[model samples]
Target: MLPLGGSHAVAEGQAVLLVAHADVTTQRLTRDTTRAIFAMRQRTWPDGQAARVFVLPNDNPVHERFVKERLAVYPHQLQLAWDRMVFSGTGQAPDRVRHQAEMLERIATTPGAMGYLEREYLDDRIQVISMD
Candidate 1:
């Protein structure tokens, strides 16, 4: 089986659990939807919720790899897209957290924020959505 802690599982056809600050939930996102959200390509979901995102700090290789391999995009590319969006006043990038612990803490405390971690760290405080 995959490692145990960081990820979440979302039932099919249900709203993907977005664990961010209350203000951030305005942007509800799915795993596929988040690729565009993070890439700054799609600004909002069909429901008109602005896509709010949470990210790992630059030094976190696990998150970087997740984005690069799973999302099929590189960190620099994601950053560049965000820069372009911000420059054009189209959209902004997701907020960044320091590490998995901080990410989990923030997600648990916040309402609409969504992020990822290894499968081993999950707890009762937040909901974990399965990607597939």
Candidate 2:
């Protein structure tokens, strides 16, 4: 399981998890697919529901750790990818949440919404997704 409960999630080495709305059927995603989803390249879940991506600010430590450890890319690289997509008019950026609380609340309330969170913040309202 992804580590949780530390005050400073990433700085203390407790990486956050990729989470989704409780009703979302997708329990596992390939790393490439997860990356695509956050990159806003994949528009729908494999189950065919439109995916709504949520993210903490790029400068957030949880966001940085998630990008590097889980997605295998730097935060700036991901930002650049999003920027290019936005500028090229091929896609838009993920919905940005102000903090982990907002990230959890947004994902829990929005159908097909997905985001990352420290495991301490997890509850039944959202489900954790595993990446291969």
Candidate 3:
């Protein structure tokens, strides 16, 4: 878990960047598509490439901020959605990494990957997908 009160510090213009493997062709995502992919309802990008989603633990400050600020959904609500999809056998849960470093590594190496991170963690190895 992140330190107490750490999430408050993320409010100063630190929007989450939606990043993917550099080779992925898709460059942008609609708000509804982003929501569905993160919710474990959408398995592929609009261009028909597989969407590989990564995330930190639910209790992590970054995860909380990304869901609430970027997705406009609460953590618990997203968790419930994932659970429903997994149980119904219609979808699988996103890959879970322990921290931002691991998330960055996974996104950089995995093809079709998608994950959110702070601007400081981004690099040329990953392509930033604009949220439309």
- TM-score for each of the candidates: 0.67, 0.90, 0.88
| Error in Å for residue 81 of model 2 | 1.2
* Clashing residue pairs in candidate 2 (N, C-alpha, C atoms within 3 angstroms): none
Instruction: Find the 10 residues in a row with the least total lDDT in model 1.
Output: 9-18
lDDT (C-alpha, whole model) for all candidates: 0.62, 0.89, 0.87
The true-versus-predicted C-alpha distance at residue 126 of model 3, in Å, is 0.2
The CA-based lDDT of model 1 is what? 0.62
Top candidate when judged by TM-score against the true structure: 2
Model 1 C-alpha lDDT per residue in residues 1-132, reported as the tens digit of each score: 543335444332122223444344233345676687667677664456554567886557756666765576777877888788889998777788887788778777765556776555566776654443
Tens-place lDDT per residue, model 2, 81-102, is 8999999998999999899999
Clashing pairs in 3: none
Q: Please give the distance, in angstroms, between residue 88's alpha carbon in candidate 1 and its true position after superposition.
A: 2.0
For candidate 1, the per-residue lDDT at 108 reads 76
RMSD of each: 7.0, 3.5, 5.4
Q: Let me know the TM-score candidate 3 reaches against the reference structure.
A: 0.88
